[model samples]
Target: MDKVQILRKISQIFFFIYFIFFTSFCLCFFGLIEKFILKGSFGSLVLKLVVIIVLTLLFGRVFCGWMCPFGFLMELSYKLRAKIYKLKKLPKVSEELHNKLIYFKYLVMILSLVLTYYLATYAFCKVCPIGFLTNLYGTVISLIILITFLIASFFLPMTFCRYFCPLGAFLSIFSIRPLFILKTNNNCVKCRLCEFKCPMQIKITENVNQKECIRCFECKSSCKKGGISFSIK
Candidate 1:
C-alpha cells in the first residue's frame, strides 16, 4: 500500500488498540463520574480530560475522530453498509439539514446537565448508548437502545455523534477553533473531491477549521492534488 493508506490504517489500528486496552479498560467513562456529587473524589476523568483537551488544542478533536472506541465502531457500520449497498461510503446528507441537525447535540448536553441536577442522578447515562455499549452488564433496555443507535448508523454516519451525543457536544465546545487545523495551502484545484469525502459534510474548500470537523484527516488523503495539510496556528 501507499504511504498515505498505510499511515491511515496504522492510525486506525493504533487508536483502536488504545481504546480496547485503555478506555474500555477504564469502563468507558475513563473514570469520569456522570454526576457532580461524585466530584469530591479524585478521578482519572479529570486527568483524562486534561490530556484529551490538551491534545485537541494541539491536533483538533483527536478523541472523537480517532481514539473513541464508539467512533471506531461507527466506522465499521459504514463499511458494512458499503458492502451491502455497493457504495463507496454512506449516502451524502444534505448540507443544510445536516448543519441544523448537528446543533441538536448541544441541546442534548444542556438537557442532560439540567436533568441530572434535578434528578440528582446522571439521567443521561440511562440513555447514553456509549455507556451501554461499554458496560454490557447493564440493563436490557440499554442494550436495546444501543442496538437501535448502532442500526441507525447504517443510514446516517455518526447518527448519535452529529445529533445526540452529549459527550460530543462537550468536546465541540473546546474544539471550536482548535489551534491546530486543516488548511488548503493554495494547492486546492477546486475539484470538490475533498468535500465529497468529508463525513461531516463540511465544505472543506470554503472552510477547514469548521467546528463540525472531527479531524478524521480522511479529507487530507482525498486531495489528489496534495492541497490539504495539517497546521498549527
Candidate 2:
C-alpha cells in the first residue's frame, strides 16, 4: 500500500478506538452534567451547542463516520449480514435512485429540530436504537429493540442510516462544508467500485457533496485505479 493508504488505514483504526471512548465519555459526561448542572443554565446548553457547531463546521460528518455509536453498529451489522445473507452479490439500482434517497436524511433533520423546538426533546433519542445500544442492553425493551434492529439488518442495507437516524440526519445537514471530502479528478476510469462499496449509497463521482456521505473512505480504499482522492481545504 502507498503512504496515503497506510495513513488512511491508521486514521480509520484510530477513529474506531477513539469513537468507542468518545461516545462512552459523551454519554457518561453528559449524564453527569445533567445530574449536577442546573437545567436552568442556558449557558450550559449554549456551550454544548457551540461545541457541536464548531466540530461540525471543522470536521463535517467525521463524527458520523468516526464517532457515532449508531454508525459503528451499522458497520458491525454489515459484516454479520454478509456472513448470514451473503448479500455482497446483490444487484444495484441506478445511481439516480441512490442519490435521491439521500434527501431523506434532511427530512429527518427538519423533523428533529422542529420537535426539539416545540417539545424540548429530540424524539429520536427517546427511542433511538443506538441510544438503546449504548444505554440499555439486557432489559426487555433493549432486547426487543435489538431483535428489531437485527431483523432490519436482514432486509435493509444500513436501514437506519438510509431512513431514520436522526444523528445521521443532523450530521448530513450540519456538515455541508466539512473540512474533508472526497474529490475526483480526471484519472479517467468509471469502474464504479466506490459507488458499490459506499454504505450510504452516495454517487461519489456525481455528488460528493451529498449529505449522506458518512466519510467512511470505503470508496477511496476500494478504488483500484487511483481515480478517487480525498482533499481538505
Candidate 3:
C-alpha cells in the first residue's frame, strides 16, 4: 500500500479503538437520528450529529473511511475473504447492477426513519449491525443480522455500505457534493486500477464525487501514475 493508504489504515485503527472503548453512544447516524426523533430533544448527541453533518458537507464521508468501527470490521472481513480464498482480484458487482443496488440504501434510510417514527420505537436498531458490534443489543436477531452482513462483506467488500447502510444513505446527502473530492488529471491512462481498489466500488473515472465515495483515498493511492488526487471541487 502507498503512504496515503497506510495512513488511512492507521487512522481507521485508532478511531475504531477509540469508538469501542471511549465513546458511550452508538455513533451510527441513523440510530442517533432515531433517538432524537423519538425523544424530541437536543443535547450532546444532537450536537455531535450536527458536527458530523458539517464535516461531511466539507470533507465527504471521512467517518466511513477513517473512523467507523463497524466499517473497519467489514473491511477486515473483505481482506480475510481475499486471503482465505487466495483471490488475485476481488469480485465486483457489475456497474449497471451496482447503480440499481445503491438506491436500496436510500430506501432503507426512509423506511427506517418512517417506521421508527410511526411505530414509536427504534425498530431498525433491533437489527442494526453496528448496534450488535457496540453491544447495544444482545438478542438472537441482532446476532443473526450481524453474521449475515459479515458474510455479505466477506463476499462483496462493503456490501452493507454500498447498498444497505442507512447511516451511509443519510450521510450521502451532504457528501454528494462535498467541498473536497477526488479528481483525475491528464496523467490518467484509464487503467481503472482505482475503481478496482475502491471498497465502495465507485466508478471513480466517471464520477469521483459520487455520494458513495467514502473519502478513503484508495483511488488516489492506487494510481501509480499519480493520476488521481483529492482536491477542491
Candidate 4:
C-alpha cells in the first residue's frame, strides 16, 4: 500500500485503541462519562473541559470522531446497518430536515446544562444511556436503554452526538476555524465518494472547514486522487 494508506490505517488503529480504553469497564483515565453518570458532582471537570475545549478550538471535534466511546459504538452500529441494508439503503433525510436536526444537539445541551445547574446535580446522568458503557455499572434499565440506542444507531448514525451530546454542543462552538483543516486540491474529481463516506454527512467538498465538521478525516482517506489533505492555516 501507499504511504497515505498506511497512515490512514495507523489512524484507524489509534481510534480502536482509544475506543477500548475509553469503554473499558474498570480503567479510568479521564473518565468524563463515568464522572458525569456515577458522581453527580463534577470532579476535575473544569480542567478536563478547559483542556478539551482548547483542543477543539484548535482541532475541531476530533474528540467526538476518534476518542469518544459512545461515538465509536454508534459508528460500529451504523456500519452493521449498512451491511444489513446492502441491497436497499435507507432513505436519506431531506436537506431541510437534516439542517434542522443539526441544531437539536444544541437544544439538548442547553436543557442539560440548565437542569444540571437548577437541580444542582448532573441531571441527565441518571438516565444517560451511556451509563451502560461507563464504570458506574448502571441499572438494568440502563442496559436496556443502551441496547435500544445501539439499535437506534442503525437508523440514526451517531444520533446521540448529533442530537444529545453536551460535549459535542460545547466543542462545535469553536470548530468554525480549526487550526488544522481539510482542503481539497485540483486532483478532486467531484465524484461525491468522500461525501458518501462522511459520517457527519457534511458536503465536504464545499465546506471542509464548517462548524459542524468533526475532523474525522474519513473524507480525506476516501478521496481517490489525494485531493484532500490537512492544511495548517
The candidate scoring highest on TM-score is 3
Model 3 agreement with the true structure over 1-233: per-residue lDDT tens digits: 87777899999888777766654755666777888779987556777788889989888998888888778888999989888988756679887998899999999999989998999888788777766556675467877877888899999998888899888888999888888877888889998988877888877777674588888786787788999877887
Runs off by more than 4 Å, candidate 1:
1-24, 27-33, 41-44, 88-90
Q: Which stretches of candidate 3 lie over 4 Å from their true place?
A: 85-88
Candidate 4's C-alpha runs over 4 A off are: 1-45, 84-91, 135-141
Can you give the lDDT of residue 170 in candidate 1? 77
Candidate 4, 12-84: lDDT as tens digits: 5576565445654322222354356456644655466667777777877777775565677777888788888
lDDT of 1 by residue, 87-120 (tens): 7544667778887888998898788777766776
**What is the lDDT, from 0 to 100, of the residue 22 in candidate 4?**
64
lDDT of 2 by residue, 1-233 (tens): 55654664566566556544545434222222222333445443456555665766776666566555555666677757667766553234456875576667668766755665567653444555544545522245544665676567545556667766656676566787777657776883877777777776666777676456766777787788888876675
Question: Which is superior by lDDT, 1 or 2?
Answer: 1
Off by over 4 Å in 2: 1-24, 27-52, 83-100, 117-122, 136-146
Better of 2 and 3 by lDDT: 3
Provide the overall lDDT of each model, using Cα atoms, as 2-decimal numbers: 0.69, 0.60, 0.82, 0.67
Specify the highest-lDDT model's number. 3
